[model samples]
Target: MSFDQLASELQVRKAASLYRGRKVLQSPQQPEVVVDGKAYLAFCSNDYLGLANHPAIVSAFKQAADEYGVGGGASSLVSGHSFHHHALEEELAAFTGRPRALLFSNGYMANLGTVNALLGKQDAVFQDRLNHASLLDAGLLSGARFQRYLHNDVDSLTQRLSKTQARRSLVVTDGVFSMDGDIADLPAICDVANHHKAWVMVDDAHGIGCLGKTGAGCAEHFGLSEQQLPILMGTLGKAFGTSGAFVAGSDVLIETLIQHARTYIYTTSMPPAVAAATRVSLKLVQTEQWRREQLTSLIQRFRRGCEQLGLSLMDSPTPIQPIMIGNADKAMAMSAALRDKGLFITAIRPPTVPHGSARLRVTLSASHTEVQVDRLLDALDQVK
Candidate 1:
């Protein structure tokens, strides 16, 4: 437990090109941003709909702040559950086509609280191999028999489900894989889960504000009913352009979380202003078909450009496009080269991804222009 061991590990990470660092952003969350005193056209943000700095959402936040003041003051079980919080939960339930929805401080807490509440040592939890770190951590902490299936392979999930003899089984996956940008086969997964009598939970953090005709998320996109996806979790900070996360499910599921989810029961509720702002964001997500349309156009344009360049790309049809680079050093070097070319895209290295699957994660937004995407393609071509 000496400090020298920690220092040695840091050195090893830096040597392996796996050390992570933060870039100070001097501007708002948008396509054009100033980071560390330099301006660049950024493609690394999760703001898929370009609503982070939207006027209406910002105005709503300010107005709610003026009325409700700044802090949450207490946990939801206490006096902190504001009118905005309650109203947003109801709206989210309707939007997600569920009986009820409960809010959490963020996506991590939502996942941690929900899984732990639902399962115990007598139960079993199965997750996709490529699930987010939060989901993986939640499963580990749940003290349940944990198993990971092959990424997005329904047969793998079904085979594992058949072998598990736990009293209860829960299968979890991300609606959209954050690193590879591919979507989950929700319909197939749901069918397998139904056959096995297991519950299906989808964390649609990256899919909520970008998919579906009305932007209700992957469940809506796949036309899955509440019974098909019993526990659905989505984050507001991504496409919704606000903060916090929520779980939408049946009344019993939600009530169980409210009572048993330590992360929800202990933490201070999200600020009322964020809830108010997200209310507006939710409305925009539903009404504005153009945002999704624009994102689709950009995704297609970028993919075609990469294909023309003969660059290796993933099977993602979503905004999160990744350029496959096998070596960690090469991924980091390519990211540095892009930064030098007046563009910003992060190199995703292990263990964020698997070993030897390093990549440049290129996220698109409705705020990005065709010309900007072309510039990114040009940079990739030059670096490659």
Candidate 2:
């Protein structure tokens, strides 16, 4: 495309209020942050367990840096797989009760590699309409016939599966929908996949380390086993409070990905220190049950306050509580108003969400106190 055409497209985006920008964060991932020289109480982070800035995690990273230097220095096939990476993979497999697991640089690469490795032009991939953009992009790039069912509707998925005649069929979904913060009906979806003779793949990036008894993610949250959920993916950047992502499943599935997944085979591995730090974070996620409990209490507190304020909240039990604001301009105004009140919540606008569903995405973390939540509620009330 010409430069003029690109400029015109940018103008069009700005005219529609759909243009996006980033805030320069000068602080670590915590309840409060300094962005672009301004400090605010933030409620938009993915650090649900609040271990992102924990002392032990930081110490682990520093210690590993002294031992392993900074980078992986090569792809895994070319000797980039350090002892830290290998141990984390093994620990993840055992934690999820899977036969094996493979780590990717991040969740995007993991989703892309897994889908492309499994499906081809002759196959069909069915997904939830509300699946993450990475999953949708992966399906489109896999050269497969892609179809999306209604969000969280097993019947819609079943109807599509019944008519599929591809050589192979795969069902893909988010264990927890990222935007809406609602958990998928995994049991029903898995049952449907089984009856249709299809494989199920769930990217539980937002569910791990928050849901379930042992932080095994959505599969554990729903009491589903590896047999029922044959393909599972989780990230360390969120609740695990580190970088990198992993795909866990049968031994054969992982081997296939290692051989065929281009994203995994070609990209440089993650930093060794990140893997080492994630190891410590993993241990904390297991041993520190109190963090999860505190998070739950905060979530309840916020929800109760929102209810009293008559906010248009979605049916989400997770920390991701989005207050529905129907118009783009209104959502932006609300976010700006909250910012003026010293609270940091972003306006999630289309095409991130559907038209007329723009919202303020408020997230809770274990490190947040009741007073902070109440303060946020007070800010919301004042802003609205």
Against the true structure, whose lDDT is highest?
1
Residue range 1-384, candidate 1, lDDT tens digits = 579999999999999999999989999999999999999999999999999999999999999999999899999999999999999999999999999999999999999999999999999999999999999999999999999999999999999999999999999999999999999999999999999999999999999989999999999999999988999999999999899999999999999999999999999999999999999999999999999999999999999999999999999999999999999999999999999999999999999999999999999999999999999998888999
Clash pairs (backbone) in predicted model 1:
none
lDDT of each: 0.96, 0.94
Residue 265 displacement in candidate 1 (angstroms)? 0.3
TM agreement with the true structure for every prediction:
0.99, 0.99
| TM-score of candidate 2 versus the correct structure, residues matched by position | 0.99
lDDT of 1 at 191: 95
Q: What is the C-alpha RMSD of each candidate to the true structure, in Å?
A: 0.7, 0.9
Please give the lDDT score at residue 342 for candidate 1. Answer: 92
What are the per-residue Cα lDDT tens digits for candidate 2 across 1-384? 569988999999888878899999999999989999999999999999999999999999999999999989999989899999999999999888899999999999999999999999999999999999999999999999999999999999999999999999999999988999999999999999999999999999999999988888899899999889999999999999999999999999999999999999998899999999999999999888898889889988999999999898999999899999989899999999989888899999999999999999999999999999999999888877
Return the number of clashes found in candidate 2: 0
Which runs of model 1 end up more than 4 angstroms from their true locations? none
